[model samples]
Target: MTPIIVFSVITGYFGLLMLISYLTSRKSDNDTFFTGNRKSPWYLVAYGMVGASLSGVTFISVPGEVANTGWTYLQFVLGNIVGYVIIAFVLIPLFYKLNLISIYEYLKDRFGLKSYRTGASFFLISQTIGASFRLFLAAIVLQIAFFDSFGIPFWVTVLVTISLIWLYTFRGGIKTIVWTDTIQTTFLLLAVTISIIVILSQLNLSFDDAIKLVTTSPKSKLFEWDWLSDRNFFKTFTAGIFITIAMNGLDQNVMQKNLTCKNVKDAQKNILWFSITFLISTLLFLILGVLLYQYALANNIPIPERTDDLYPLLALNYFGLLVGIVFLLGIIAAAFSSADSALTALTTSFCIDILNIRKTKTVQKKTRLYVHIGFTMLMFLVIIVFNSFNDASVVSAVFKVAGFTYGPILGLYSFGLITRKKVKDKLVPLICIIAPILSIILNYNSEKWFNGFKFGFEILIVNAILTMLGLWLITIKPKTSLN
Candidate 1:
């Protein structure tokens, strides 16, 4: 597991992605970059999304979390299934019927220009931070495993990380991502499966014995019935539903891929198939967590201070060179899968939603190329910032922040879909801003006011509700034509 081998593996992986990008970007246009010309195969999009949705955060953090929280995360995963179903039936039809390139266009048609820009603004901010945090985690791991050995600085690693993604994704956009993501997803899943097999062999446990071991272990406990706990099944499940809606259905990064499909039917199939694969993939990660813990306990190894470090520690140091290589590939694949798409989505949102590049129909290629490069730089700077101040668990930090930033998106979409009331267009920004602030205050003091009850991912639900209520306060009845 020398740094040279790790570096070589990463180089080879990036080369493959670049090749895919070149093939996809040939004779590409703005339509190809934005929507893949509405010609993407549903099955490929479904398979690729498994990697983008999970990202590097899930790759490293989910297994780390299993040691502390056991199987309760599965409750969140179940809730995601419900959310995906809603997207397939409800959101996909709306996007398709409107023939939307940017989903935020619905906001303009439903409300006004202010609402549309507000929605896109929130997404840009949300995806920028989300993408940076994800890359930050992956960069940190690379720094420790490879760069540190050579005394290479963290900032250089961040630049190289982002540069590689930009190189592959700059030209093809969604079209390229559709294919690269499938390859990355395959590598990610393969890495995890192989690591699991290696660990199982080390433990000398058959498949049935491994299943029984995890099922019977103390960490196997799944449900939390108490309402006061943050991990309460009801709270986590509800949060999962809203999180998926906000983070996927309303998100340009996720929805952009869905929009690349041939039609609503293809998009629906993609969502359905992706949801099923995502469920199975998550379950496998949870099982991997249980095995890692059992192996550590049996071998008298001390668990790392940060739970996220456990999988990397075992794969690199204890499991053998092959396992370590797999771990590196898995994490790099997970990171690139999400980051490349995020960059494209941000560029798409800004060019179409903010700058209205499609409407001008002039110098579109140049504008999009510049925006893509701009976002890549922005992401690099943000990841550097995260390295300075980040101390909490990466997965928890992502969801907690998402609850606040994505809350307005949830509220905006909920209001548009559920009511015919028109809101004060100029005041929409104020409402979106206040909702997350109030959610922060409430989350910070829930224990004092709610008799010691804590908020979990459910904070997202509360934030969206507050935003919706604020919108309702400013709503006015639609005027009918009296011809």
Candidate 2:
């Protein structure tokens, strides 16, 4: 894998994405950009979402994490199935009934104007951070493989990465993403499948032998019954459910695609199918992780200090030229599938939720185009900032941040749906801010305060609970109607 070959593969891949954009964006308007004219096929949305849901973080980080955590992450994946079920039955119907362009609009109907803005603001902040961190992972890989040889700086890599996403996404928006993601998902799965085959060949293991190796390895341990450990099955499983509810059900990035379907039924079908496929995809990644570690051990290769680097290190240095190319393609596809959608969702939230762009239809198109460009720059800058300070595993870092930021959203939506009491709208923002802060304090001191209990993804559940409590304390009963 010369730098030239890596660059060429990326160039060809990006060209395909731009071609899709050109085809879908023609005669596109605000309706198409935001909702895909509400005519997207249910099955395509299901397929594309598999790519978006996995993102670059899952592509590289999840497999790498398998060495340390083993199959405990699957507990969280099972929880995701429960969460997706809730989204399909509970959240989808609400968004559909409201005919929402931005899912946050439900806050306005349920609470008030301030609560609406508060929810949208939280989403903007959460998505910006989440998307930036994801792009940062991809940019690092690109810099190592392609740009460093050319003496390009990291910031330049960040700019080019985001700029490429903006180029394909600026016009077509969700309309284009629905189709492009399907293509990206195809490549992503192919890359993973091909890599598995190549690695099995290198190790001289047949398919049955490979399965036997992964299943019988110590890394195959999936259950943890220790109540005090963060990886405990109950804790991780519960956290996965809430994480999905908050990150997917309440997230504009994920829900925007779901909302593109023709109706509630189609959207539900998409969620159900996407959930099943996503689970299968995740199982494959975990299996690949087991194989990578096994191959390294048998070859007497020292594993990298960072688990996230294992796949890249082996593929580029030892797996020969073809595996190197497959690695690059898989990562690039995963990166764009996630980043492109995040950009669109950020722009959509800003225009609809922050600036009320829908109210000013005359200039909405121009305004949206500008906002899209602006967010692209913002993400580039955020990625640079993250690069300066980030040291932890990115997969852990992303879920940690999501726990804090998405907590208020989970709390807000739960309150609106489960209760009839009216809230003090002006104070909602303060409660949202306070809940995560309290969660941080508790998480930092969990061992002392709770008899050596460690928090994992379940921290998200705590944060949401605190937010719900805050909201509850501020609630007032609805006034009785006079007869």
Model 2 residue 160 lDDT? 87
Which portions of model 2 miss their true places by more than 4 Å?
480-483
What Cα-based lDDT does every candidate model obtain?
A: 0.93, 0.92
Q: Give per-model CA RMSD.
A: 1.3, 1.2
lDDT value, residue 154 of candidate 2: 96
The lDDT, on a scale of 0 to 1, for candidate 2 is 0.92
Model 1 lDDT per residue over 1-483, tens place: 899899999999999999999999999989999999999999999999999988888888998898788999999999999999999999999999999999999999998999999999999999999989998888888888899899999999999999999999888899999999999899889888998999899989999999899899878789999999999999999899889999999999999999999999999999999999999999889888889888899999999998888888888889998888888998899889999999999999999999998778475899999999999999999998888988888999999989999999999999999988899988999999999999999999999999999999999999999999999999987778998
Q: 80-141 in candidate 2: lDDT tens per residue?
A: 99999999999999899999999999999988988999999998889999988888888888
Error of 2 at 94 (Å): 1.0
